[model samples]
Target chain A: MTKPVLHLQPRVKTMISNATLEQASYEIMKKAAIDIPEDYLAGIKSVAAKESEQLSGFVIKTMINNYEAATEDRRPMCADTGLPRYYVKVGDHARFDGGFTGMERAMRSATARATIDVPLRPNRVHPLWRTDNNNNVGINSPEVEWSFEPDADWIDITTVHKGGLFGTDYRMLFPGDGIDGIKRFLLDTLISFGKRGLCCQPAIIGIGLGGSKDTCMQLGKQAACLRVVGNRNPDPKIAELEVELKDVANGIGMGPMGFVGSSMAVDLHIEVGHTHTGGMPISVHTFCLSSRRATARIHADDTIEYRTDPMWFTPYYRRETVIWENT
Target chain B: MLNKVNLDLPASPDDIAKLAIGSIVFLNGIVYTAREGVYNKVLVDGRELPDDLTSRSNVNFHCSPAASKNENGEFHIGGVTATASFRFSKYLAQWLDLTNTKIVIGKGGMPVNDYKNILAPRGAVYLTTVGYGTGALLGRGVQSVDAVHWLNELGIAQALWIFKVKNFGPFLVDSDLQGNSLFAQQGELINQNVEGLYDGLKEPALHRYGETGNRKDELM
Candidate 1:
């Protein structure tokens, strides 16, 4: 005996995509460029004189190089070959055609193809021995972080990148309350720690404020891709702090690659959390100049849309100015 | 202001094989890429490599050679970083010997004693970038991945090496002429500062009435 397949009016849809390794990653790199707004580029110039000159040629060249390489070779632009990370922004009206494990399988296919196609340097070695195992794949390789939003149409898929390379950002640990305690770590980070930690690129600073130690770090990395290029925190106190820190960072005399540039940090994005009665933990994760990321909208209609030009997504380059500040 | 300078440079694979043990390079040209995880699966299990891989000739690309572009328009290049391989510096030295790789880029000077001999024989060079500066260096437009060696079964963000490169940057010799690395100096300075402060604390003249321990010891 055989069971009959059910056929009815379609109320929802699902997409199980498997791109060649290189093809999938190339798509992600394209979207990262469009996500950064034109106004944000202008605003960065307004605050810092150096950005105007440096960003002019810098952003375009980066995008062209990033898009071309990623598309042509089907590999990631920077080699941190970051931890296999995924962001799923799902629509409420839609339902997965298959169960949880099935979705995992689809994403896994995408990641595997990216691994082979992108040819990212496998980052995970045994934590202890540090052996160079050849497989770029790992347990929980493509980490899927999901967010369900109330929306019609269908689910949207976007590639969110936080550079996986070492010293890609700054991490500040708060032991307890004291001016000296925080100052000491802050200064050290800006000095050798910042130099070594940031690897000497103009970076966006992700500040994890008032959270559990681990959450603080997560907030910093998660926020790394958020806070649109030229946007600011709504909180007044945080906004002021961002301004003050920018000034102090520029004062560090750490030029380009820590040699001597106008400002080592581009901007600081700070996120706060509830602290223990006695302690506070703060950290900073720096995103390198490449700032590689992109977004793709996989609609329910089987239409794959890219927000940025998948063929060429440029970084910030010198351009006309437009400022947008909302506090 | 953009300052441009061009110099014809020769990179000896042997020298780089030696120097890269404890140095980082600001690379920007077609360079090969590999990840530890992928190798572990394939080599250990006798897995099949992707088509046209060895013929692609990764060895010449891996070492410090002058810039070259693969068939793909993208340049194969990169600034050196803390490649997890620094921990396997010894094994990679042997790998480089087999591969004929001439240049390597990354941060954190590798341990000099580990593979100076391996590098010297090949005449390769190791280059270092400032740590935490991948963004700045990459932003400067050095290397972009060109062609890649694929182990497709592997997943996203896990490819072996997406080969590419463009501009090349500076790799300061943090190690001394004798191959002593500068990282130690920085690390030592930090250790000394903390140690000295601990030793320099003066005794608290007066003690708290409900003190759990002696004031002098706790304060110090």
Candidate 2:
């Protein structure tokens, strides 16, 4: 596990080149568009093996073939390349040549280049006028979200091309509504979008419980896109809930394309934040069958290493107790 | 076993009638891509059909291809996937009657009633792209770009694409001539057992006015 930009001095740090960052960004975009992640591929295959319905089975088998075809031909796996976006983690100790604005420009430039090079669908458009630059780059399009990590010297750029429409919802429930309320809303979302395969199950279902409405949505989206199958919440009780919810979802008697079977979800993940004492706000996000995501680790040495896992959630990131040493 | 069949493009009336609700199909010959953008243009805007659209293809796909043009103006097609079909239901009747389209291919099929009322009545059947994610496999079948319209007006996602394809599908016949639909049938079967999922699950303290508790009825 070679960390890009590892072992930097506390006082003297190397500044990463903006061009190198853009280059890494572009490569990740192509990799995410063309290659199905190994974690997701394995997860879907397991679900497909358990799928009993003939039609549902056929859909999974064909998707496997589609993955192969996409790789062989070096094309976007799905026609709807989805809304390309970035989740970047910056190291507190690391330095970069470009200012924040310059970094943003590099990302935008990379998005346009990948849109043409990978021939991405250019799906982003203005909400009012329906205007397109034909490069998938527009105002507030290809959103870049930033987070920070302490005591690290590498910038991890993760590109997630999540489908824009369907399979996501938010609800506000009272504390009295409890886990049962969570389960009910989860069922509503899954069954609602799962019908006719609109959500494109078997998917990675991410649930965000407890947070401000916007934060709730963000946590759920990150949970679905960043985490891999078989990963669980750090808290044992929450992990248990994840497992129970996964069972409840699959027991809905639906599979791929909403056919009768046992494979509605490959896995379900949950992320939480402290919320209003009176409200339990929750959001659900489904990362579809294609599950397009790839990451690049840009080290201080200007070397870029690509990987499938995002590793966005760290112990410090999810610090249950504040990490401050002094009271 | 699931029934499988191959149908030539500009399908004849006989071929349309023989398709069963759940049978898988592979298409040969020409197919044209149209979605809300093209639908609004032709049906709502009262624009004339592009020259020879029907003569070139009878199958109308609700799709946006992963396509772009290089400096040389040669189009590069990466993949093609269908969008959900239900959103386009309002225009299907006018579009079908106007063009004599015999096949409508998209992601999820239109609402069950739309199939019986609008499509079957107009001699049109809906074919759903299998998995909805098989863009690459389908892209492989596109042999040539015969023509494209509205590239300047409607962006690539909404442009009218005339693709000459071969063995170009593994689509499931969603609606037959009898107005039967594969999705509705499958939904009913799943709904029968899914009702148990809500057992002992409590509803939220407050409900949205538009919310429906009937799980059997889908949100679509």
Best by lDDT: 2
After superposition of all CA atoms, the RMSD between model 2 and the true structure is: 5.4
Every prediction: chain A TM-score: 0.68, 0.94
User: Which pairs clash (backbone N, Cα, C closer than 3 Å) in model 2?
Assistant: A4-A299, A5-A299, A5-A300
TM-score of 2: 0.95
- Evaluated against the true structure, the overall lDDT of model 1 is 0.45
Misplaced by over 4 Å in model 1 are A1-26, A29-75, A125-136, A151-154, A168-184, A196-200, A300-302, A308-327, B1-105, B108-126, B129-220
Report residue B82 deviation for candidate 2 (angstroms). Answer: 0.3
Q: Across residues A152-228, which tens digit of lDDT does each residue of candidate 1 receive?
A: 44544555545554433333333433434433334445554344333434566666665677877766665545454
lDDT of 2 at A10: 75
**Candidate 2 lDDT by residue in tens digits, B1-220:** 8899999988999999999988989999999999999999988899999989988789999999999998999899998999998998888888999999999999989898998899888888999998889989999999989999999999999999999999998999999988998889888998787777788877677777468777665543
